[model samples]
Target: MRGLMSAGLLAMAFTLSGCGAQPESHEAHEAPEHGAAAEDYERGPHRGRMLRDGNFAIEVTIFEDGAEPEFRLYAYRDDKPIAPADVRIALELKRLGGEVDRFAFRPEGDVLRGNGIVREPHSFDVTVTASEGGRRHRWSYASYEGRTTIAAAAAAAGGVRSERAGPATIDERIDMSGRIEITPEGKAEVRAWYPGRVLAMRAQLGDRVAKGQALARVESSHSLQSYTIPAPIGGIIVEKNANVGAMTGDRPLFVVADPAMLHAEFFVYPRDAERIRVGQAVALRSLSGAARLQASVEAILPTADLASQTLLAHVHLPASAAEQFRPGMGVEGSFVVAVQPVPLAVRTRAIQRFRDFEVVYAKSGNSYEVRMLDIGRRTPEWTEILGGLKPGTEYVTDGAFLIRADIEKSGASHDH
Candidate 1:
C-alpha cells in the first residue's frame, strides 16, 4: 500500500513539473518575435536589423532642443563597440513610429553612456535594438530624461562639449590642407611683350643668363627683318613653350625671372580669408611637416575667386630659398594675423579635441591635465592660444594621436 501511494505521489509531482516547464520554454520561444523588425531591416542596406544581446547594447543622450540629432545604437563585442568596417553596419536607418531613434555612444571604461531625445519635450522614448548572426533584440525606456537631464549628466561630468556649455580652451587651431603654386612677389612676364617668330632660340629651363642677354632673335613685323631683344633683368629661364620652330601668339611663350626672388602661392578656402593680411609675417613650411622654408606675407587679394571661391595670398621667399623652391611645389604656411603680443606657441600634434572644444594635455605638477583653450593662430608646427591656457605648456606633441584616437573611438561617432 505504501508503494502504491508513492507511485501516485510521483505522478502528481511529474504533472506539476510539466506545467512550470512549458511557460519558460514558451517565453523563450516568443522572445524573438521581431518579424516586423526583421522586415524593417530587410529594407536597409545588407538588410540590416535592430538587435540586442550580452555582447551589444544601444544608448542615447540628448542635450539641446534645436541641435542636430546626436544619438546612436552600438554593436559591442567583448564589452567594446565594433567599428563599421569590421562589422556589417547599415548606412541607412529607418524609424517605424518616427520616435525610436539611434544615438551616439560615449564610452567610459567598460560601460557606454549616451543621450536620447524626446521630441515631445520632458517625455520621450528610448529604443535599443541590434542584430547579430541573423537574430534581433530590442528594449526601450519611456521615462528617460529630456535635454535637461542630459545637460545635467554632462554638467556632472564637467560639460557636454562647447565653450558656453562646457569646459573650453583658448586655442582654436586645426590642421587643415593647403596647396602650392607660383608666387608673384618677384615675377616677370615673358610675353610676345612684342610679337615675333622663333629664331635662333637657345633658352631652356634652369639656364642661367645675364641681364641684356639675347633670348631669341626674331624677324620683327615692324622691321620685317631679324632683330635682337635682350632680357631686361638677370635671371633664369624658368618656363619656355617656344622651341626652335614654335609659333608665338599673344600668349606668354617664355617665363624668365631671378630664381632668388621666388614666392609660394597657396590656394586656400575662404574660411581663412579673415586670418591673413598683406604685411604680416608668416612661416612657410614643407607638407612633409617640417619647418624647412621660411617666408612672409607680401600680398593678399582684396577679392577672391567667385566660382572656385579660393583666397589668393602671396608669400615672399627668402634669398636662401633660391633655385630650390620650384613652382607647383606643395607647401603650408602659418600666418599670424592677430597676436596676443608675444604669446607662447607649441606643435599642433600636442593638442587634442574634446567634443566641440580644443584641448591640450598639459604636464602640470607631475600630472597630465587635459586643458581646454580658445585656440588663437595656428601653423602645422604650433598652435596659438588666447585664453584658458599658458605658453610653453609641456605636453606630448609626438604621441597625442593615440589620445585623440581614443576619444573618437570612445565617442563612437561615424566621423571618427
Candidate 2:
C-alpha cells in the first residue's frame, strides 16, 4: 500500500509540473561530450539534444506546447530523416534522492514519443538507449535544474534550517478585548461599628495594608469611648472617605481591594456568546504586550450589559500576576474554542509562491527542491497538507525564501 501511494504521489508531482508557466531553461548541469566544448554541439531542425555516433543519430526534445511535457525523439541516418517506426528508444532518469523514472517510446507521426511526463526540478542523470536495424546504441548525460548545494557553514550563516514534515494541532481561537478588575469577593468595605467621629486616620489612599491593621481611630458618640477601626481585608486602599476629624455615619470609611485577586471581564457579543463557556482556556496579554499569562474562564455572567448588550466572561488571574497587571488595565485575549489535529502539516511561514503553485523547499543532503502542496485548513502557525508531499520528507521550515531566491538568481529554467 505504501509503495502504491508513493507511486501515485510521484505521478501527481510530475503532472503538477505542467500546470504552471514553464521557465526559460530547465537544464542546470549538462555532461560534456569527450574531446569537444560542451556548448559546441550539432543541432537538428527540432532544436533538441542531438546525439550522434557516426552514421546513426537521434534528436531528443521535450514537447510541451499547450500540453503536458513528454519526450519527442526524431531519428536520422547519415543526417537524413528516418522513419520513426524503424527505431525503438528507452530512457532512465535518476533523480537527486536516487529515485529513478523510466520511459519507453512508441512511434507517433515522425517522432517516437515517450509514455511519461518529465517531472520538474529536472535535475537528474539521464541514460538513453536505442535499437535500430538490429544494431544497439547508448548514451548518458547530466541535466539539472532548481537545485543548489551550499556548504553547511554557508547554510547556517544564511539562516536556513530544515525539519521533517509531520502532524500538528491547530488552535482555533476567538479574539476578545476586556479589562482587569478585582473579583467581587476580593473587595471589602471598612466602616466604623457605630456612628462615630473619626479621631485619627492611620492609613491614606493608595496605601497597602494587612487585614486587621489599624486604618482609623474612631470615638463612638453613644459610649464616648475611642476604638480602632482595622482594615476588613489585606489589600490596597482604593477609596478613603474619612479624614482625621470627620464624623462617620452610613458611608464606608475605606474601600479595600485586593489587586492580587483579579479577573479579566471579557465582553462577548450575542454572535460569539454561544461559543464561550466556563473553563475554556484563554491567553491574556496586556495592552502593551509586555505582560502575558494563561488562565481559564471561571464564570459567564447570565445577564448582558444594558448599554452594550454583551455578556461577560470572567477569567481569574493568579496572585503572581499582580506584579505586572493592575485593576482597570485593558487586556487582549485569545480564547481557544477548538483544536484540530491534522496528519501532515507545515509551518505557514515556510510556504512561498512558486510560479502558479504554493511550495516549500524540500531538502535532501545539501540540495533543495520545490514541493507543491494541496492545502486544507490553515492557521497563523500551521497549514494542513492534503496532497503533493510525502511523510517524513525534510523541508525548509525557516529561510525558505533564501532558497527560492538562489534558484531564481541562477535563472534555472523549468523547461524540459
Candidate 3:
C-alpha cells in the first residue's frame, strides 16, 4: 500500500514541475531585452556622452564657436555633480599609426578645460583619468570623430601621389607689377641719309616691312635724281610723317618695332631697391595666368620715379613668346631674390585650408590623416614646415583637394 502511495506522490510532483517550466523559459528570453536597455549610453549636462569608473564620471566635448577646438570636461561623482576643484583630470589620446598626445586640465568654475587647442582629426582612442580623494580612476573609449576612408583604386584614379617630407630649397621671391613694351633693341627709327624731297611713299602706317626694304622714293637736294629710302630693320611701321611731296631732313620719318620681342618694366619700392641687381632671374606672366615667359633683369635704372619713389627694373622677353603676348600688354614678374634651405619641407600643392588651420593629408599605408601644419617661408613649388609634421613622414602631394572633397562628403564635420 506504501509503494502505491509513493508512485502517486511522484506523479503529482512531476505534474507540478511541468506546469512551472514553460514560464521560466519565457522569462529567460525576456531578461536579455532588459539587459540591453540598461547598457544604453547616457549623456551629461553638457549634452556630451559620458564615461564612468567607480563613483567618478567625465563628459568630454569639443567646444568651437568662433574659437579654436577645445576639450571641455564636466565631472560627476556617484551620479551627482562634482566640484571641479576637488579632482585633477588628464587625457591621453592615441591616433592611428602611433601618434600620441597628452593634455592636462585645470579647474574652471564647474568644469575642467584643456590649456591648448585640441588638434584635429579628433579621431582617436582616448584615455581619461580622474583623481580625487587620493584615488585615480581611468576610462578608455574609441572615438570616430571626422573619420573617412578611401579605396586605393579610387585614390589612384584621382591622380593622388605620395611623397616623403624632407629638406628642400625654398626660393624667396619678390612680386612686381609691370607692363610689356617693345625693347629698345627691337626698335628702329627711319631717317633720310641727306636732305631730299619724298618722290613717292611705298610703306604706310601699320604696314610690315623687311630690312633694307624701300620705304619711299626721295629726290636728293644735292642731286636732281631720285633715290629710294630704305627701312632700317624688319618690323611694322608704327609712325609715318613722310608724304609724296614732303622734304626729308635729319628728322625721323617712320618708327619701326619688332613686336615679337618685348620688355617688361616694373618699379621697385625705395626700401627694396637695394636688392635689385642685374642678371637675376625673373618670371613674367600675363594677368590671366595663361601666358608665361622667362626673362632676366636686363637693367635697373638709376633714376627713381619722382612721384612713386620707386626705381625701374627692365626684364627682357624673348622673341619666341610673341604669339602669346604683345606690346603694351600688362604682366606680373616674380623675382627670385633668395634661396633658403629648409630643414623640413613639403610640396606646396599638398596644403589645404581646414577650418582655421592649414592642413595636409598624411599617408600611412592605405590611410590618410588630416594633419595641421605651422608653416614658415614658402616658394611656388615648396613650403617650409615649422611644426605639426615630422621629417621622413609620407604625405599626399597631389589630388589632396579631391581627398578633402571626399572628407566633406563623408560628413566628417568635427568641431573646429
Most accurate candidate by lDDT: 2
Q: lDDT by residue for model 2 over 112-134, one digit each (tens)?
A: 98999876555567778889999
Which regions in candidate 3 have their CA more than 4 angstroms from the true location?
A: 1-41, 45-49, 52-92, 100-120, 127-140, 249-251, 413-416
Number of clashes found in candidate 3: 0
**Count of backbone collisions in candidate 2:** 2
Tens-place lDDT digits, model 1, residues 1-416: 00111221221100000000111110122211101111222111112222344555332223343774333334556645555333332221222123233454454443333444323212222334444566565553222110111122222232112211122222233222455544454456565535667676767788877877878776666666776667666777877777665556765656777767667776657787776667776666677765466566777776778997987777777777755566566877666665443355555666776555677655322222345577666655556666655444455454344334433432212110
Model 3 TM-score? 0.73
lDDT of candidate 2? 0.78
2 against 3, candidate with superior lDDT = 2
User: lDDT tens string, model 3, 76-164?
Assistant: 88888888889888888777678888989998987788888876666665677778888877766555332334556655655678899
Error of model 3, residue 192, in angstroms:
1.2
Clashes of each: 28, 2, 0
Candidate 3: the clashing residue pairs are none
Candidate of highest TM-score: 2
Score each candidate by Cα lDDT. 0.46, 0.78, 0.74
